[model samples]
Target: MNTGDLHLLTGAYVLHALPPEEHADFERHLPGCPSCSEEVRELAATTGKLASAVAVVPPPVLKQRVMARVAAERQAPPVVPRQSRRGGTRRGRALSRFALAASVAAAATFGSVALWQYQEAQDARDAARRTERRAADLASVLAAPDAKAVSGGFAKGATGTVVVSRTLDKAAFLASGLPNPPEGKVYQLWFADGGSMRSAGLMDVSGATGAAVMEGPLDGASGIGVTVEPAGGSAQPTSDPLALLTLPA
Candidate 1:
């Protein structure tokens, strides 16, 4: 099978749904592809946990009752009379078509669910990588010898701190005890010189606490300011800043 087809079978392989022939092919490919290997491992572990969580024991008499029913079913007479050769051929063809359609439908449903789950797993991995990068940037700024800290509150209850590396032109901001913005509004950051301002980044103030790291040429900036703006932020400050911190000369 091609790579695309083989990737789609990762979910099936984990669930033991693939045929023996395809299973062998996928096994050969699994060793060389880290993405597929990792996905299969995660899916297999999740499936095992789910299986172990729901353990149901049949009643002692359940097997005996099932065998009795099967014996009675085997003894029942056929509902339809034996057909002529041509009629038997037509009936067989119809049964084959019905079975094929049902199999296709079931396969489609399974493939869609597997694809969705894989996409969600990929999204989670991307978010985790972004968070790791952010943490690393914060650590670097904190460790810099020239780093400076500025703290203030935009409103009565909202307070935040900005840590800047004077030699590196990087900053990390952390805020806490902030109220949610008004409808259709968001918090935006700006690097301000004496006469003009440039946007540093935008922030979501929905939570009581939020943090972000900023990297740019900040040598010319005289101060950092925060303001309420429309979602996605603005090119310039459209309203008065809620808080401002002047950088030391």
Candidate 2:
């Protein structure tokens, strides 16, 4: 499956919510993509921790309240059926037509309201997901045994430092004390063998200490550099590096 398909179902797969068909599809793709597998494990572990922390306490009167409401609703007068009456008169036909129209209107209104509520709930879930992702990222960085702070020179008087780590599956870069770029520019990190370069991460230099971090697979990087580039960054550096550091392995 394509990267888009894998990402689309990653969250569901992490929670084990996919149907059998989709589960098989995700399994087929996982072995070929280490990044997807790592993200899935991170998400699943976070979700499992959350689940374990939650207490299960059904409301004491929940069943009774529900059954009482259901009974009351059942006792309510039945909606008049809209079928044509046998040997019906004009008035009877008019009543049936009115009832039919009312029923349709009610159903439409309820459906619209339900749709709106579902959309609102979905928006809430999206926001919660973003917060969870940010938290997970910070947690992962904090938990890494190899993560550490390092420093280097920048333009003339400017200087910067970054937290760096090389994990078995991925690399993480975090920098601070760097100046922000021009309005249309951004800060980008590069992986270099001292002579050649590869884009490591696209970054922002606006935090209090101008902190930004990127996590990606880099099994072959030898050194690292930071440069100022266009917002989305380029495949290669187009300007002199503002900071540079060498990776251990």
Candidate 3:
């Protein structure tokens, strides 16, 4: 019915997650949109590889949760960027959290402090690898050669910024001094193209400041718009925007 964000359905189509009606819509959509078609091909190929790589398939619920998280958020945890207007270091908090997770996982597995200490070297290496990978993913756009950052203001001292890199096909949405989203709503980003927009996933914002790596690529998107959407992001923005920041060509 609503083919507005048919591009966002690639993942669902690949996983057979779309409802019958929406599946029909997407099938109709897949013919003409090269980007969505290409994405579906790549994703389907990857899905095949992953399916064959594992000896056993995951439970349906686990698969659903994984797909939901990827489709909904696809965001890095909130971290103050190096150029944060509020003026703070970036990366440290995220890295610390990763290390903390590693230590917790180690403790849970070993169940004894001495046992954890015995495996300290191996665990530390695992933690280092995890943190490195996460930080790299989060900073991909920020560190890109063509990265550009823009800032704008919001009501009640709140402010927003967007950093984009067409080269990296990524963008980061950052904000400060905003209230938590209304109970069932979340901050959603859009790739503004003229009057139309496409979903760019959701953010996990919780306090005075937040930052997230937006979902989807930057091509064809003229700017970024933020809005409050129902929990697992929307196919299109449903509310007035909290901020709109244009990107350079």
Report the number of the highest-TM-score candidate. 1
Question: For candidate 2, lDDT tens digit of each residue in 1-249?
Answer: 544345345556654568998899889988876655665665455444433422332365744663454334322111222352232334433333343333333434454566667778889999999768865775676467887656566665566654555563444555545566788998887777557987767765555245444546555766678888887889888998877776654
Worst 10-residue lDDT window for candidate 1 reads: 73-82
Model 3: per-residue Cα lDDT at residue 231: 90
lDDT of 3 at 121: 68
Note the Cα lDDT for every prediction shown: 0.68, 0.58, 0.68
**Candidate 1 lDDT over residue span 74-122, tens digit each:** 2211122344335544543344333323333444445456666767888
The clash count for each model shown is 0, 0, 0
- Greater TM-score among 1 and 3 belongs to 1
For candidate 3, the lDDT comes to: 0.68
**TM-scores of all predicted structures:** 0.62, 0.45, 0.47
Ranking by TM-score: 1, 3, 2
Question: Mind giving the per-residue lDDT tens digits that candidate 3 earns over 4-98?
Answer: 34544665677676899899998987887775676567556655544443333346575466445444533222222335413222333333233
